[model samples]
Target chain A: MKELSLNILDITENSVKAGAALTQILIDEDASTLLLTIADNGSGMTKEVLQGVTDPFYTTRTTRSVGMGLPLLKLAAEQTDGWMKVESIHISDDPENHGTKVEALFHKDHIDFTPLGDVVSTLLTLIQGHPDTDFLFRHSIRGGEKEVEVHMDTRELREALDDVPLNEYEVIKWIEEYLNEQYNGPEDAEE
Target chain B: MKSLAELQKIKANMKQRIVLREGSGDIRVVVGMATCGIAAGARPVLNELVKDVSEEGLSEKVTVSQTGCIGICQYEPVVEVFEAGKEKVTYVKMTAEKAKEIVEKHLKGGQVVEEYTIGAYQS
Candidate 1:
């Protein structure tokens, strides 16, 4: 993907398809390094499934033969002189605690590093497409006068929404402005 | 800065509209967003569809969502439209511009843009 946000969207789709009720997308970045973590409370994979996940030929899907999400993400990370890792515990193995966590670290100073594009749009798309599922998004930047963070949890929104759906047009629009305002800061928004 | 408090105001406002239209949308716009599709640029197409649908006031009648691969990787950025009483139309290699045109002509004007369909590209 041209933007790392696209990769984030693609990987998170896997979690949704796996029937994850809650997914957490966390990002931590500094001047030289960026870390992205997508953890989902979904039906985790078997050992064999985990082993083949990074292979472009391996896929749990019946629609097509190839699964390119993990492979492409791995390439993107490694090309930036960084790494990617996956940890999972299948439901068959441990029903109480079964989920998947994918972490990709990229050295932002490297020439091959991909930009984290409009992530607000990515989060909105996720909410719009899968309104029933919940998402927790937190993005933090470390190299500033003070650490800055942008946070959102659907669990909290769901409580506030009551019977209204999260994908309601006004809800989505409000979220877009909310996130953009956060990213831009109140002072910048005033300008 | 925007806050969650404002979402409350929106929730209150949307409740009236929701009660007026209780059922789901009659048409569905599904954008393919698998690896091939994203790498080929489906995000912009999706954003355009969502923006256009809302701006054109077609939100009540149409729903724009996303899906995984349709097993046609060659046609990287594909879009499928489903109407209540019509055949599914697949548009391939779509861009944001084309998405806007589709929204205006096919969605708003009730006339399909035949040249953008998969059949036109193949034959």
Candidate 2:
């Protein structure tokens, strides 16, 4: 759970720095299942780049960039008694079609993505910091046969945040709402 | 909480004012947000710029933006300012404190912090 939150924060930072115009996040957690994905329309990587990114030794540079975040995410997803996959395509040729997609799925093994909450905090942090960029966050949790999407009204938390840019204090509060939506929503909010 | 949709209002307002500000030659605050920039904490600087500028009602005359790596990673998160018909000034190793100084000393008083600029390093 804690690992997932850190993964999200790290991935989003990569998306922003990748020169993405828009970044998308989809997190669906139900009592029995959890599916998470982060996608970006940034400078896509080539097949070579994609193959290398997941490598622990892979990095953007030899200095300052440890390049651990994405790979760590891959690890958390795959090790979480679930499934994980990553894909990317270079958009330089057809810029419109270029994008990188990363996914992590957790099933009933109860790997627990409940801790280290603050998805909204995580998402909102990226959005607020990069006003020049656009981001979409879609989250859902399972019910019976349906998935309930907990729509948070926390975007307005932007104004109250005042001069702070996703500070730890504010981020903690935002995470609370995120946890509620994922773990505390109606039995079947998706339907 | 604000709706993501309401960001339209911000955009709409920026659109309407962009032309006026450009024509009128307002002070533009440019933050270095390249990979080096964000990793160096450009996010907080950007937020401070947005919030302070708005709170001070300086939004009409000052605008904030993000840019990619400037190859000057050692000096990031840098901020540069371009005023009408003036030489560009780049501030290196900028924190919230330095950002505010740029606002008060340069943006408002029309005087560059010659000591804190990239030129300072070149010298």
Candidate 3:
């Protein structure tokens, strides 16, 4: 994907297809590196599937032949002198044990790394598209010695709604504003 | 930032339409969103469908959704329309503009646009 947020959207779609009730996305950036992590409480992949996830030619979808989501992410990380990892375990009896976590680390200063696209829109799209699934997003950025973090939890928003549907137009607009306020605090407002 | 009261106002105004849309709809519009589809620019197509459907007040009759892939990488950015008691119509190499046209002719006018369909492209 041209933008990191698009890649996030693609991978989270995979989590939804896997029957995940909750997906957590985290983006942490510092002076030296940027880390992206997506974890899901879904039907975990088998050991074999996990091993081939980074291969561009291997895809679980029968539609078309190639799966570029993970492979492209891995390539992006590697191009920046970084790496990616995937961990999954299947234990039906234990909900915690049955899930997948994917983490990709990239050198922040590398020219090859793509910019994070409209992340606020990406989050809203996911929330509106899949109302039943809960999502948690955290963005933390550290420049020099100062660090700031912003977090959003859909479960909490759901509780505040008193059964109002999340996909309502007004709710979506509110979410956009909420993300903007949280992501761009007064101290580091984007111009 | 706007308060929840604003949302409540929208909710009250839209409650009836929302209920009808969610209760039943026979028409389904599905956009392919796999790796190939995304690379071929399916996001805009999907967004256009959702926006037009709601704006045109066709939400009560047509539902828009996304799918993984349609097994046609060559036809990336494909969209299929399914209506009750009618054959499914598949549109190939879709764009936001074409999606809008589809919403107008196929979904609203009840006449499929032959030029946009995959069958037309093949022939």
DockQ values of all predictions:
0.65, 0.05, 0.30
lDDT of each: 0.90, 0.64, 0.82
Residue B90 of model 3 has an lDDT of 95
DockQ computed for model 1 against the true two-chain complex using alpha carbons = 0.65
Q: iRMS value of model 2?
A: 9.9
Find the 10 residues in a row with the least total lDDT in model 3 chain B: B1-10
Q: Which regions of candidate 3 fall more than 4 Å away from where they truly are?
A: A62-65, A92-96, A144-150, A181-191, B2-14
Q: Residue A76 in candidate 1 has what lDDT?
A: 97
True contacts kept of 2: 0.00
List TM-score per model, in order: 0.96, 0.58, 0.86
For model 1, what is the error of residue A190's alpha carbon versus the real structure, in angstroms, after optimal superposition?
6.5
* Chain B TM-score for all candidates, comma-separated: 0.95, 0.76, 0.91
lDDT of 2 by residue, A91-150 (tens): 776677877788887664554443535555455445555645656677776575765665
| Highest DockQ against the true fold, candidate | 1
- Alpha-carbon runs more than 4 Å astray in model 1: A144-147, A187-191
- Model 3: per-residue Cα lDDT over A1-191, one tens digit each: 77788788888888888899899999999888989999998998888888888988898867456788889888888989999999887655466668889899999788888787878877876876787889999999888575768788888777666567777655776777778777665434453
RMSD values, in order shown: 1.7, 8.6, 3.5
In CAPRI terms, model 2 is classed as incorrect
